[model samples]
Structure formats: C-alpha cells, structure tokens
Target chain A: MKKITLLTLSFTLSLSLILLTTGCAPDAKSHTGGAESLDSGLPSENIDATSILGAESGIAQAARPDGINPETDVDYSILSTETVYFNYDSFSIRSSERAKLEKIAKWLTDNSGKRLMVSGHTDTRGTLEYNRGLGERRALAIREYLVGLGIAQDRIFTISYGEERPADTGDNENAHSLNRRAMPGVITK
Target chain B: MRSQYDLNSMTKKLYTVLFAASLGALLSSSLFAIEVEVSGTKKIAVQISAFQGADAALAQKIVTEDLRRTLMIDPVVSQGSYSVAASVSGGSLNGKLTDTARGSEVFSRTYSGELRKMAHEFSDDILESLTQVKGFSTSRVAFISGTQGAKELYTMDIDGANIKRLTSDKSISANPSWSADGSSIAYMSYRSGYPDVYVIKLAQGIRTRVAGFPGINSGPVFSPDGQQLALTLSKDGNPEIYTISTSGGSPTRLTRTRGTETSPSWSPDGKQIIFNSDERGSNQLFTIASAGGEPIRITTPGTYSAEPCWSPDGSKIAYSTRTGGGFCVWVYDIATRVAKQVSPGLAEDPSWTCNSRHLVYSNNGSLYLLDTVTKQSARLDNGLTNCTEPAISR
Candidate 1:
C-alpha cells in the first residue's frame, strides 16, 4: 500500500510539471511560420487591467452616443499640431513624430476628462480594404504610444478613414505624404 | 434535234431544284439544332426583330441592350442562328424566341410589369434557354459614390439603370458587402465620425450597427449561411479576424498574430475563411477555419495581394495582386492551385457575379465586368463619378 501511494505521488508530480511548463510557455501554434512574435513584452498584469478597463468603457459608451458627429462637434484644431505623420506603407512611429505624440499624451493627462480619438488616414496607393487596415494599425500604434506614457487605454479611441478622407486630394507625392497621417483629436466627456 | 436537246436540259434543271429543296428541309430539321458551347470566344448570333404594338420599339431597344451586355450573344439584323420576336401592349409583353436555323420556337411567354423590367426578364430567359446558366440581368450592384469625405452608399441595376441612394450620411463609407440573400448590405461607414460596420436591410430601410468595436470595425463580410459575419476588428490588442453574429453580439476572434488581418471572405460551405494578412511580412492571402485555427497561407510571399473574394461555385478566388506600380485582378483556382491574372491594367476590389465566370471590379473610378474565360472587360456606366468598391449580389 505504501509503494502504491509513492507511485501515485510521482505520477501526480510529473503531470503537474508538464502542466506548469505548458501554461507558462508562449502559445506555440500562434507563433508558427516564423512570423513576428505575438508578445508585446508588456507586463501581463498591465494587459489584464487594461482589457478589463476597455470592456467597462465599451459598455459605458454603448449606453450613450459617445462618438463625435458632423466633424463640427469637436474643436480638433487644439491638437492640430499633434497630428503625427507616417512613412509610406508603414505604421511605425518615426523619431520625428515622437515629440508630437508625447505632447498630446501630456495634454491628455492634464485634461483628465477629455478623451482622444485618433483618426488614421492613408494615401490612395493600395487597395481600399488593405489601406483601411493599414490606417487602423497606424492609429493603434499612436494609441499604444500614449498608453505607454501612462494614459489609460479606455481614454483613447481609434478610427480609420482609410484613403476615403484625405488631407490633400491632389494626386502628387506631396498630397500622398500629407494624407498618410494619424490625427489626435480631443473629445470632451 | 436542237428542240430535243433543250427539252432534256429543262428536265435536268427541274430535277436539280427538287433535290435541293429536299436537302434544305432535312438540314433544317436535323442538322441545325443549336447546342450550347463552352467557349467564351464564340457568341450566339441573335437577330432581334422590331416588336409590334404600343411601346414596342422601347421594349425592343431595352431587350437589345440587355442582350448585348451579356457578351454571350451577338445581335445581328439578319441571317442569325436565333431570332427574338417580342410585342408590348396594354402593360404586357408577348415575347418569343425561335431557333432560326431549326425553324422551331424555343419558348413563348407573356410578361407584365415595368417595360424595362419585363424586357430584362425576357432577355434573361433567352440567355438561360441558350446557355443553361442563370443570367445576371436582374442582379444589382451596391457601390460607394461621391468625392472626398462626402461619399455615400448607392445601389443600381447591373446595367447602370435605376440608381437609388441608400445612405444620406454625408460621411465616408467603404467596403460594401452583400448578404447571400441580397436582402441586406453590410458596410463600413464613418457617419458617427468613427469607422463602424452597419447593415442596412434594403426592404424595410432599417439600419443596424452590427459592429461598433472601439478600434477599427471594418471589412465585414456575411457568411454563406447568413447567420454570421467575418470581419476585421482591432479592439483586442491588434487587428485580428473575428466572427460575430449577424444580429450583433460578442465577436469570436479567429486569428492571433502580430500582423494585421483584414478582408475576410467565407468559403461557399461556410467552413473556411480566406483573408488577407501581413503576418509573413507582406500582404498575402491566408485561409483559416471559420471556427478558429492556424491559418494556411494561400499566396506566395514578397508579393502584395488583398481584397480576396471567393467565387460562388467554390472553385476559385478572385483578388487584386500588386503588379508593377498598379494592381491587377487575378483568379486563383482552388483545386489546381494555379493563379492567373485576368485583368490588363489597374484594377482593385474584385467581386464575383453569381455566374462565377464574370467579375465586377473598380478601376479608374468606374466599375468594370471582366469575363475571366475570355479575358474581355466592359466598363459599367453607372453615370456616377468617383465610384469605387463595387459589391454584386450573388
């Protein structure tokens, strides 16, 4: 009876070790094809907290008409200088545009009640659906920067206009460069 | 002697006429029956006779134009293999199609409705009888129109008639996708000053916000069963593929990658979804189970491919691939695993018609239908400027 008890203990220990390793390891199936790593390397607790906050804020926004309308409802000119531009076919924050986002992040912290709506735009170079996705990634990149600087994830909303709304409608390179941008507009509660 | 020779020559002439007449009758009854051919290059020669009665000429004109647009029939004045006889009177149209070579009536029907609609019906019937394939005459296309931020959603007939504005939102709208039943359209609109997916039931004019995710609710495509929608949502961390109930509920994420995923199209069986992803570096096509699984890449890396749409027959996928400085339409055969470029110049947003052989895509601010078999394309004149992103009902 004592030998049987010892065998059960060993089996239990091995099973627990396997479970622990798998639970701690990053998802192997998700990282196939040598694709970019899924981890953002951010604190796990921080991500969980932000997700919970995001859910609560989503519910609150759903209870009311929270988004801006008519393009005249909000005075976006206040943060006009903070409109960050991106390179062609890219969403990475350039070193030149870092200062603008930092200023906007500080302004958001100072005005705690105000939320930021990052409207992402793209040039008319790619397919419309793909551009919409690209524009979205650009806006999310800006939001991530702000969130990294201590702004709450729930306070920033991102929208992609794609190539539909352009800052300059000309077909020249000058217009395209101006069109690929992420504009941070302040929305009051 | 000369009179005797003339009598013999006359007898021979009489015999020749009788023999020729008998042969003609035999050919008409047995040899000249029309059979449908699979080749797209050969079009049936159809002679449309002017109709008789009130508004008969108008009916003739409408039918003629509709038949010409099919690219399967060649309208001729005479010596046609087939002939159409139609008459419009008292809000009804009496139409008849005859096999000219066989000298037999193929079909005869009476249609009553709007003159244009009745004519379209007759034309469709003629095509179906000749080709054994359903006609696209009654099909409608929903597209986005207007310049800059003032774009709105509009629907019109395949021939560019009966233009109807579906949305008056002075805000921008993009990526209009049709439900399989053609009763509703789901599109991404910025009317709320944010990109949100909205579905408009064409009959009751009821609009519902199906997806209002916090960040980037775009590229909404209805499943084949119409019970769910596959879309790209970035509400969770990064842009990912998700499926949500058509009536609006919690979205089920289908893809997990650091790359951006968009343009999700469901297979005909509704089991698999083909979408565009940049997970492998460049935008390429990938297929994943609708329920959620690891995505298998469909296109070669290093080339940009996007806006994928599965053909109705489940045999092929039509998408736009980036060519030297411009985009071209390509159809990828699922079985053979071969991709063929079907368009010559700049083309994007390819949506397949119900026939699956033709595609309606936007190029240079206009929509064009391309015959994949023949590689021939015809511009669709919607009479609207700056039109793009065309979605045709199956």
Candidate 2:
C-alpha cells in the first residue's frame, strides 16, 4: 500500500512538471499554433494532456472538439469476446458467427442503459474506400442481426475502420480472415 | 564547259540556302506550340542557365526538378527552344523566360516567399507560359498517415515537402478529399468513436463536422464548386452516395442501390459523378448525373473495380482494378471507353494532378506520382511510412 501511494505521488509530480514545462515553452505551443489548437476551442483542462504533449513533441495531434477522449470514455474490451468475423471480401455474417451476436445482444439487454458501438474492419486486399464501404456493410449486418434479436436500433452505433485497423497484419489467408471482423463495444448512452 | 559547271554549283548553293531558311522559320514557329494531345510523346526542351546570387544552386535544383517531374519540359544546358534565366537576391527570386528561337522574352516575374515555394511558382509560371496548362508544383496533397497506428490527416506539397499534420485526433482518419480551391479538406475521422465527416479549413485551422449520421459516415469528397460534398452515408439503411451542402444541412440522396456504393468523384463541370458500386454482385465503376438520375455502369462486370477518380479534364477516370490477385491503377478513356492499366502491382487510390496527365496513387503504404502517357513513375518520399489515401488538390 505504501509503495503504491509513493508511485502515484511521483507520477502526479511528473505530470505536473510536464505541464509546467510545456506551458512555459512558447515554441512548443507555437509549433501547434496551426489548425489543431484553433479548431477545438476548448479549455486546456478538458483537452487530453497526452495528446497535447504529442503536439509539443512535433507530432501534430488534434483534440476532440467536444473534449471527450473516446479511449477512456468507453471500454470496448468488455465485449471483446463477442467479436464476430466475416468471410473473405464479404460482410455477410456466417452462420457460425450468429452465436456471437446473440451473446452481445443478451449483454446489451442485461446492461439496459448502455449502448453498443460496432466497429467493422476488413482485410488489406482491396482499395481503402471500397473496404470502408464493405466494413460498413459488415457493421450494418451485425446491427440488423442485433435489431432482429430485439435490441433497439437507436441503442447501437456503427463505425468502419476499413482496412486501416487490422487485427492481424499479415499477408496470408489466416491473417486476412482474422482481420475481417465486426467488434462490439459497450458505451454509455 | 567550266562556265556551265560554275552555273550548276551556284544554283545548288542557292537552293541549299533557301532550304535552310525555311527550316529555321519552321523551328521558330513551332517553338512553345501547344500540343493538343496529352500523350507526353513530345517534350519541349528548355535551357535552365546557372542561377546567380545567394541560394542560386538550391533554387535552380528545385526548379529543374519541378519541371522534370512534369514530363512535359526537358531541362537542358544549351540549344533549347526556350531558356530560363534566374537569380536570387535578398529573399526574392527574379526569373525571365525567353523564347530562344525568336530571341523574344516570354515573361519575367519576381517571386517572394519560401525558397522552395518561390521556385515552384517560377516553374509553374514557365510551364503555363509554354503549354497554356497550369502546373501542379504548388498544389498540395492531403493524405492519411498511419504511422504508429494513429491514423491522422496530413498534407504535403506535391513534391512531398512541408508536411503538416492537419489533425491529431489520435484516432483513425481516412479518405481525405480536398476542396477544388485547395482551401479545405473533407475527410472522415473516428474521433468521437463513431465515423463522422469533417471539413478542416486549412488557413483558419477550424474543423466543422459536416456529417455525423447514425450509421457509418465516411468518404467525404468535395464537389468541384467547393459548396457540396458527395459522401457515403449509411443513415438511409445501406451505404449510399449523398450530396450535402458544405454547411450542415439535409443531405440529398443520389443512389438508392441495395449494394454498397462509395467513393463518389465529381466531374470537373460538377454535372456528373462517378462512383463504385457492387449492386451487380461484383464491384464496378458507375456514372450518374450530379442531379438525381439513374447510375450507368461504366466498367465491365465480373472484374473488381473500385475507387474511381474522375480526371480534372473530364477525359478519363482512373481507378483500381483487381488484376492477378493485386490491385493496379487503370485509366478509362471517357471518349474511347477503353480502360488501360497504367500501373504495375498493388497500386490503388489514383488521384489526378491538375494537368490530368499524371496520377498520384498509393502502393504498399507509399505514394507515387505516375505520368499516364509516358508510363514514368517516381515514389514520393515524404519520410513518413504507412501513408495512403492521397487526395491531390486540383
């Protein structure tokens, strides 16, 4: 318990020191004085400190306009096991993947107030734009299946990563099949 | 006998002089003549003399490289149809283009800006004066750089310099499409944990969410007029093409296809849109009137074709076709209706330069500039790995 407290205290001191150094350095702020800083129009407290530090380090990063970090706002890993896979160049949910969606639907029913965010993905074999559309279809297919399972349509949101975020970054068939998927995440309404 | 021989020799010498005079006149008349065909078969030779003053070598180098990449101008040391005389002094570049054949000045201008930008401007001016076609030297390409798995929107000069990250969303961003005037870029980002279309004004650094519909909101491409964006939205059930005003408003649906439709590219005149669809079981290119109408299949079915980009000149549509288990960039002649493969292996997302004779495509995570007519290509070295979805400003 004592060690945990000490570590927490050191981490807090380091974070504050970082903020002080970044706040004092005009050059660091000036480097990000372009579009990103002007776009958010949000206060510094609401902005993600790591993203600001990323900008200070010359990696230009944009803060969310609403000042919400989705990574921390919603935990996607809660429904990780319920993720469904798709066929090659296809968004049709295979018969084998039906149980996964049923599990997710049951979880959504149990949670009641929580919504679902289904992120669709594809293998890196086709054009990015086309894959994006395909990924959307995959997510929509899952949404339709979940809706059929009695989940409300408005309670689900969908996004497509196309081939951008691949589960497996390999060039073989196994990786391609593994990459094509629709992952369900639990999000607060 | 000697008198007769002398008369014949004088006649021969007179004829030779006459022939030389006519040839010289022809050469002078053809100097800087505009070639109607953009096949890049003939290149005008321009002599770029050694620049004078500070930063002379750097200025000359950049200008020469810009001209060379066009595949329209051949830079030589001497004996060129045209010549460029340049000098840099006190943060200013003065350049003069001369028609060597007629010994007349074409244009002279003074440019002040970043050294590389000034050089590009000078090169563009030279190209315009010679061919009457605008050069793409000053144009920028907005692309998605996926370095470290944090896909972000970034823009760079056509020559791959001055890279600026327009978004640090710390999330996936893709399909960057620039406004016709190059003032703004419309792209999709998952910043809010959902796909949303946003337009970022480059000068002001302001971003406005244009489309955040219930389902997937993606593939936002600016219309030629920069007023409307034709994008893919699944709000109406399936992925379909819809046009929305740049400002937030109700979107006008263009396609009612049950299959997926995305990547809508507008015609230069803003009268037509060519996009990709899989309504026939396989993805194919289709064209439709910008106004509500039926979509006409442009590519043959059975083969996979997607990511259709209409050239700025409205003469060709460049797209990626599945060939030999990999994607290759192919250009479909609008007039001839013949599709010819312009790239070799794994080339996709072909974006045309302003000249419409060159295309910038992504292959294996690197962007490449391709001269469609000459089949010459060069990899754009932006020093960033995993860069894709290049949208060159027309």
Candidate 3:
C-alpha cells in the first residue's frame, strides 16, 4: 500500500469535486491521463504515484461517475435529459420553445418531489465565461417558466457550462449553434 | 383640469419672488475677496439670462437648476456657476455677451444659443469637477441594430440623434469600437463563415477585415491612443484576451488563464482594462492593468455583469447587471462604491458621448439616449430585431 502524498490527495480530491459538477466518464483510462494533465500544478512524479494507487484502490474510477456508460440494467438510450436552448444572449422565451417547455412544465408538476437540474450553454462566439453565464441564463429561463407554471423554484437548480460542455463540438457555425443549449436532467425524485 | 395660464402665473410668481430676494441679497452683500485656489481645472460659469425682468443672480440660479436638470438627462454638465449679474443697468443684453460666441450667437446654433459660451464653461467645469478628464461633448456612438436576421451597424448622436446606418452588407455585426480620432470604427462582422473583426474608415469609405483568426475573434476595444486593440481570440484553443496593433500585427496574449475572457473596455487614462470574466465563478466585471497584471474583481453581489463602458471623465463605470428580478443598467461611482441602477429596466451596453453627459443604450431592441441628469430619454429607432453593445467615439 502506497501512502498518498498531499499533492496527489488534493489533485484527486478536486478531480472528484469537478466530476460532481459534470458526471461524465467515457473511459476510465482516458480520464486518469486527462485528470493527470489537468493536474498541471502537481508534479509528474506525484501524478505517477497517484495513478498507481488509483489503479490499485479504484478511488479515481468511482470519482468519474458515468450515467450514460454501458453499465447496470438502466437503459440510458430512451431516457435522456430534457433539451432546451436560448437565442443569442437573450433570456426571453420565443414562440418555438413553447411546446417543449410546456411539456417539461407538465412533467415536473406530475412528478412532484423530483429534483431536477437545469444546465445552460452558449455558442463559442462569446467568451467562455459569458457562455457559462449564458448557460445559467438559459437554465434559469426554463426554470422561471416552470415556476410560473406552478413548479417550485427550489425543486430546480442550475449550473452553467459557458460553452465548455458541447453537444456538438465541431468548429463550424452549425455545431456552435447546437452546442449553445440547456438540457435539464433529473438527479433524484 | 387646471388651465395653462394658471401654470404660467405660478411660474411667473415663483420667478418674481426669486428675483426680488436675489436682487436684494446681491445689493446688500459684500465680497470677502477670497481668491479660491483653483485645484486642477475649474470650469465654472454663471448663465446670466439676457431676458428682461430676469434678475441676474436669480436667473443664474434658475439656469443652474435647468442645467442641472439637463445634466440629469445628459450627465454632461457636472457642476457649474450661473451668474445673476444681469449686466445690471440698461437691462438690454443687446451688446452684452450672454455667452462666449456672443449671448445671441447660439440661437441659430441651438436652443442653447446665447448660452453656448456659458454652457461650454459649464461643460468644461463639469469636466473639471468630475475628474478633469478630457471633455468630449462632441463625441458620437456607433451600435448594431438587428435588421431582418442580420445586425447592421449604425452611428448616431450621443443623444441618439442624426442616426445613419454605417454598414448595409446584411451581416451580423457585433462589438463596434471607435478610434481615438473618432474617424474610424472597428467591429466584428460574420460576413464570412466565422466572425472576424473589421475596421471602416469614416473619411476613406474603406471597409476591411482587421482580424481573421482561425476560430472566434471578437470583443475588440481600441486602445486609448487608438494604436492597439484588446480582443478575445480562440484560435489557439480556449478563449483568451489578445492585443493587436490597429495597423495589424500578431496579437499579444494578455491572459493565460484557461477559462475565457472578452468584452475588454479601456479606462479613459488607458491605465487599466475592465473586462468580463468568470475565473471567480460567474460572469462579472474585473479590472486589470492595461499592461496585464493581477486581475481585481469589481462586481460583488450581481450574478451577471458585462459590457462595462468607462466615463470619459473616469469617475463612473456603467455596466449591465442581472439583479434578482431582471437586467438593468448599473452605474458604479468609483469614488464611492455606491452602485446605482440608472435605468429602470431592460437596458444594456451603455456608451458615453464625448462630453460624457449622456449615455446611449439598447432597451428592448430600441436604441435610446439617456440623459443622466434630466432622466429624459429619446428613442433613436424602432422596428429592429434586437440591438445591444453601443460604443461611443471621441
């Protein structure tokens, strides 16, 4: 058993903390290196030390949770988060989003006590921070409408991606357009 | 309903009482002969009404109040003196100079006619009282108005007058900035597949791309000297702030932070750059050395604040903030961290005129020039998709 150094302990700790924000894990091996790469503040020796302990103890593996991964009996295909989006920097609702948001309002009302999370996103045209704020703005936009429809505001929480987590990460305008969206997902009921 | 004549009578009585008391006070008074030391640049003057039956001191007071009201709308006249010294004799200001270019010189020029010189003095004094910054009443603003689906750039008076569309190419134009000389403007246009910054010369009628990065290149802010621009570029990877020469050159990286930064606005002195960032968590205004040093967060309570425009006098910074209710334009007085919501609701991207008296912004897809002192507003245009990000040129 290798003793965990302070730097590795903190690095792995924060990696789990960030994972708490966006629970995505494509592959276990890919994330360790990425988390190691993200651990620029920590030295390579410490990262290597942590990587060995991570493989043995499986602490790093559990931190990167994946709801969409090929695991368990839950069919993640048919079940997906509610998709929503915003127009440019505006938070107002357009006529197009009425049908989708209306269904969402009904679903939340019927499924009372369900803890829903709304995440926002924006195009790469603006600043990342701006996109994140826009993402939050988009989520809040839906959250407000849902509340207006009698959904309790406390039942919904928001996190902003600010153009970071893209549904389509292509370089073109079309991809950027699709990436700017807010998709509400349920964490608990 | 009250008659119009009754209102006039009340006004006349108020004026007469002010005149009698003011005249009596001036006549009975004596000057202490205290020569007040001028601090930086005291631009104070009394607006002596050249009107008959108008007492000099009283008229000065009245004009001062009116000027203050105009200031409420314009924020151009900071502080000034209005003289009641009504050329005290023949009662005729026929030959007397009511203002600088001759009290009567400006009637043809403006309603401020005969009041120009004194107003200029008031304006200059305002410049002094505020921060002794450059007086820029003659400045202008250029902004984008969404036409059809495309956004077109338009230039107008600081008070939203004489509006003329500067670009008609039917492209999505964003982030309009004025050169120091106020002759040229640089804005981001998506005429190409990806958005790029373009500069248009007012004198030469030349429109050319300023920056064509591989990815996003936007949020351009012309340097105080009009030599360089600080903008956001994502060509290398994630978004970052880069400065390029106005003449065109490789952009120098200002921030190495992995997170993004954009909406760079220069302080009047050009000593610092206030930009929108989220390194702290959410989008808020932050100030950094123009030379690029440690970033200081300026926003505290607000969750969202963007497009910060500095006053020409450098006393206040106007930015858009999302209160718990909705978005409103907030003015942060530098001397006192007292932030005030100047506009009632739905206003953003404030631009200060040359004089820095009035600010023009977008309110619900319409361009509006807001008088800071008078609290009066005039709509510049209607029938647009949506407009925001107004930039004033000196």
TM-score for model 2? 0.77
Question: Which tens-of-lDDT digit does each residue in B1-394 have in candidate 3?
Answer: 3777898899899999999999877765633222221221232343444434334443344334433333331222222232222232222222122234343332211122343233333443434333344443444668777643467898764434457788876656778889878878988875663457888888898987878764457778888888888887655443567788876779887665434467888898988888776444446677777887666667434556777888888987887776644467777777665666777566777887665656777766677766554445566553445666777666
Please, what are the lDDT tens digits per residue for candidate 2 over residues B1-394?
8988998999899899999999888876666354434335578899999999999999999898889888788899999999998999877999999999999999999999888889999999999899886788888888888753589999998878889998888888988998988889999988877779999998899999999876668888888889999998877666788999999789999887557788899999999988887766668778878897777777432368888898998998888888767788888887766667788566988999998888899988899888887677778889998888898987
Candidate 2 CA-lDDT value:
0.80
Which whole-number lDDT from 0 to 100 does residue B226 have in model 2? 91
* Model 2 chain A lDDT-worst window of ten: A31-40
Consecutive 10-residue window with the lowest summed lDDT within model 2 chain B = B32-41
Query: For model 2, what is the alpha-carbon lDDT of residue A175?
Result: 95
Off by over 4 Å in 3: A1-179, A182-189, B1-137, B158-162, B373-376, B381-385
Ranking the candidates on DockQ from highest down gives 1, 2, 3
* Winner of 1 and 2 under DockQ: 1
Candidate 1 Cα deviation (angstroms), residue B272? 1.5
Clashing pairs in 2: A35-B205, A61-B168, A62-B168
Candidate 1 stretches greater than 4 Å from native? A1-70, A106-114, A152-155, B1-38, B300-302
When summed lDDT is taken over every stretch of 10 residues in candidate 1 chain B, the lowest stretch is: B31-40
Per-candidate local distance difference test: 0.81, 0.80, 0.59
- Against the hidden reference, what TM-scores do the models get? 0.80, 0.77, 0.52
lDDT, residue B388, candidate 3: 67
